[model samples]
Target: MDDRIDVASLGWPAGLVGELDHRRLKAPSVKLRSARAGEHGDVTYCVDLRIRHPNADEYLTSTELHSVEHFLLEGFQRLLPEHFVSVGLMGCQTGFYLGFVNEGRSEVLCACLVRILEEMQAATVVPYANIEQCGNWRNHSLDDAQRVAREILARREHWLDAA
Candidate 1:
C-alpha cells in the first residue's frame, strides 16, 4: 500500500467523474439521469450528497453521520424501492453517496431528499443504534442527526458540490 497517499487528494471515487457534472446543479431540484447510471457499465445510479458550507462538523458529526446513514438507507428504500441501490458516507465526513438503479425517472432526487430530511428531523429515535444491530451503536446521536437534517431542510436547494 502507498502509505504516503493523501486522502484529501482523493475525495471521490474516480469512476464517478465521468457521469456527474456536479458543478452546474445548484438549483432547488436535480433531475435524475437520462443516461444509464452505474459502475461504468453496471447500470447503477449514484447521487453524491455534498455539504456546501465550511463548517463540516455542523453538517456531519460522526454520530450524526451514522444516524443519517440509517435514515437514508431506509428512507430511500421506502420512497424508491425499485431504484434505490445503497447509501454510504464519505471518509471525509463532508458528504454521502446514494446509489440506485437508473430508471430514468423524471423526478428530482435532491428534491425528494428534502422531504426525507423533514421526516428525519421529526424522528424521535435513531434506528439501528443497538449494539446487536450496529457495529458502533453507542457512537450514534439522534440529536445531531436531527439538527443537521433541520439545516438541510431549511436550505431546500443545496446541491452536490464537485470534489
Candidate 2:
C-alpha cells in the first residue's frame, strides 16, 4: 500500500478548489438515511458523509461551511458536475446530506466512499494546534487531513469514471 496517495490523475486539468467557489449552491436538509422503518433500500454508489462536529450548531459557522464549500467546488463540481444534485448539512446531527443525479449510479458512488474511508484509515495525524484552529473532526495534523481530502478527490475521479 502506498502511504502517499497521488491524485494527479483526476483529469480535472487544474488545481482543486482554486477557481470554483462561486458556483456552489446549498441543498438544505436532505433525507439520506432513515432511522425510521421502511426508509432504506437500493442505496448503492453515493457520497454519504458523516460529519462529526462537537457542537452541531457550529455547522452553521462559516468555517465549517467553508470546509464543505471547498469540497463541493473542488471535487464534486469538477468531477461529477452532471451527476451532482444536492448538498445539505444534516439537520438532525453533525452529519450532512448527499443526493446524486440518479439512483442508478449508487454502486460506483459506494465504491468511491469506501476508497475514501480506506485512505482515511491509512492517514497519520494532524497536530493538535491546527485541529483546534480548523475544528475538523479532530485536531489532526495537516498531513492527515490532506491525505483524507486527497482520498476523497482521487476516489471522486474513480467514481466519476465508473458512473
Candidate 3:
C-alpha cells in the first residue's frame, strides 16, 4: 500500500509538504499536523500540541481544557485576527487543534503559537467564560490553563522539532 500523501497536490507549498512528509515518518509528537487548501481557496492548518502524549496515562481535566479553549480562542483572535478560524479540543483531552485560514507556513504558525502561549501565561481570567458567552460557563480554571501554558511555552523551541 502506498502511504505517502501528496500534500502539494492538495495545494500545500512544496517546502511545507516536504517537511510534513518528514514528520509523518517519525514517532508521534507535538507539532503542526497538516495543511490543505480549503474549498474557498483558503488554507487551513491543524496544530497538535500533544500536551499529553497518547502513551501517557494522564489527560487534561475538563475544567482545564475548557479554560484553555477560552484562552486560545480569544488570544488567537486578538493576535491573528485576519487569519484565525477556530480552535477545538482534542477528544483525547491531550491538546488542541488550532485552525487558521489562509496561513500555511509552519514557521509563522509556530510563532503565533508562542505568542498565544505567552498571552495565556499572563492571563488573569478566561475570556468568554461568563454566562452570556459560554455554554458551560461554570466549567473553567484560569490557574490550570496558565500552568499548562507555562509548560508548553517552556518547550516552545521544540514545537517544530517533529519535522
Candidate 4:
C-alpha cells in the first residue's frame, strides 16, 4: 500500500509540489496542505502558516492571533478583492488557513501575505476590533500582533515552508 499523497494532481503551485516531493523523499516537515478546484472553476487552497523556530514561541498568543486574523481578513480583501475569500485561525494557534477564490500562484499569495504583515506592523489599531464588529473585541492586542507580524516578516524567505 502506497502511503504517499500525489500533490501534483491536486493543482498545487510549483513550490508546494516541490516541497511535498522533498518531504516524501525525506522526513516529514511543514508544507502547504491542499488545493481543491470547485465546480465553478474556482480553486480554494488550505495553506499553512506555521512558525518553525525552535527557541521562539511555538504558537501565537490568543490576542495576537485574533488581531492578526482581523488584519489579514481586511488586508487580503483590500489587496486581492476579487480573489480573497476568508482567513481562519488554526486551532493550534501556530498559523492560519487562508482561502482564495481562484488564485493559485503561491508566489503572489506569499507576496500578498508579506504586504499584509507589513500593514499589520504599521497599523495603529486593529480593524473591526470593536464591540459591534467582533464578539471578543476587548481580547485583541495590536502590540502582540505587530510583534508577531514583524517576526514572521523577518523570516519571509521561509513563508512557503509549511507544516
Candidate 5:
C-alpha cells in the first residue's frame, strides 16, 4: 500500500465540503445575514461547522472548540454564503478551521462576516458545545491544525496561480 498521502485524490468530504459546493441549489435559500462596506480588495467570508457524533461522552466536551465552529457557521451564513469557497474541519483541532479562497474582494467578505457575527450573537442553538471534548480535534494537536490549514491554503493558492 502507498504510505504517501494522495493529495490529488483528496476531495473535501461531501457531507460538509461537497454539500456547500453546490451553491446554486443552496443560494436561493441562503439568507443574507448582514452587510458592510469593503475594507480589503480580495478576501472571502469564512464559516465553521460542527456535527457531533452520536457516540459523544463526558470526556469530549470542548465548548471552545465547538464555539469556534458555531462562530464560523452562523457568522458566515448570516453574512455571505455566496463568497464561500472551501469549508472543512481542521484535521487536528477539535473544530478549529477556516474558510478560504473567497470569490470576491476582502471587503465584500468582511461585510458579510459582520452580519454573520451578529447572527451568531443572536443564535439560540449551537450544535457541538454540549458534546464531550474527548477526541483530539480529529485526534491531532493545534500544530496539526495549523499545518493542515496551511497545506490546504497553499493548495488553493496553487490552483489560483494555475488559473
Candidate 6:
C-alpha cells in the first residue's frame, strides 16, 4: 500500500502559536505553510490566512466553498469596506485567502476572521445556502466548516508576524 499521506490527515494549519507571538508552524520539509504579510505604496496590506481541513477526506464541497465565500466576502466588504478586498477558498479546498488594503491591517483581518468563525459556529443556517441563491446549494456543510473554524479559533494565536 502507498504510504504517502493523503495530505488532509495531517491535521494541521493549527498549532502555529509560538510563545504567544503566533509564528509560522511548519511541518518540516513537507510544505511551505505560513501566513504572508506585506504592503505596497497605495494598495492595502495583504494578509493571507492559509488552512487545511483536519480531515483530508473531508474536502470542501462546492456548496461549502460557495457558502463560505459568500459569507466572508460579503460580510467583510460590508464590515470593512475600506480594508476588505477579496475572500475566497483555495482551489485545493485547503483554506482561504483574504486580502486587505491598509497598514497594520492583519490585526483587523485576523480579528474579523475570528469573529466570523465564532459566528459561523453558532450559525445553523448559512446566509446564502439556497437553490435560488446558490449554484451548488445542496452540497454545503455548515457543520464541517464550523468545526474547522472552531479549531482555528482555539489556536487562533498562531496567526501572527514572525518576520
- Top lDDT hit: 3
Per-residue lDDT of candidate 6, residues 23-142 (tens digit):
332211112132223433444333345454333453556655666776676667777887677775768664566665542234455667777778887887777778898777776677
Candidate 4 lDDT by residue in tens digits, 1-163: 0114344443333454422432222111224566666666666666656643322446577888899899989998999999988888777666676777667566677788888888887789999999999999999888988887887787676454442
- Please, what are the lDDT tens digits per residue for candidate 2 over residues 1-163? 1112222331221232112221231222111231111224322222335433334343333344444433443345445666656656556444455655434233444544444444444545322334444445442244434543454454343332211
- What does candidate 3's lDDT look like per residue over 5-104, in tens digits? 3444433344433234432422223455566665566666666656765535567889988998888888789878998888889897877878876664
- Candidate lDDT values, in order: 0.59, 0.38, 0.69, 0.67, 0.35, 0.53
Q: How many Å off is the CA of 106 in candidate 4?
A: 1.0
With a 3 Å backbone cut-off (N, CA, C), the pairs that clash in candidate 3 are: none
What TM-score would each prediction reach against the true structure?
A: 0.67, 0.35, 0.77, 0.77, 0.33, 0.62
Clashing pairs in 4: 30-162, 30-163, 31-162, 31-163
RMSD of each: 9.0, 16.3, 5.1, 5.4, 15.6, 10.7
Off by over 4 Å in 4: 1-31, 52-57
C-alpha displacement of 74 in model 5, angstroms? 3.9
List candidate 2 segments past 4 Å from native.
1-48, 53-62, 111-163
Supply every candidate's count of residue pairs whose N, Cα or C atoms clash at under 3 angstroms.
2, 12, 0, 4, 13, 4
Error of 3 at 59 (Å): 0.7
- The stretch of ten residues in a row with the least summed lDDT in candidate 1 is 1-10
Q: Could you give me the TM-score of model 3 versus the true structure?
A: 0.77
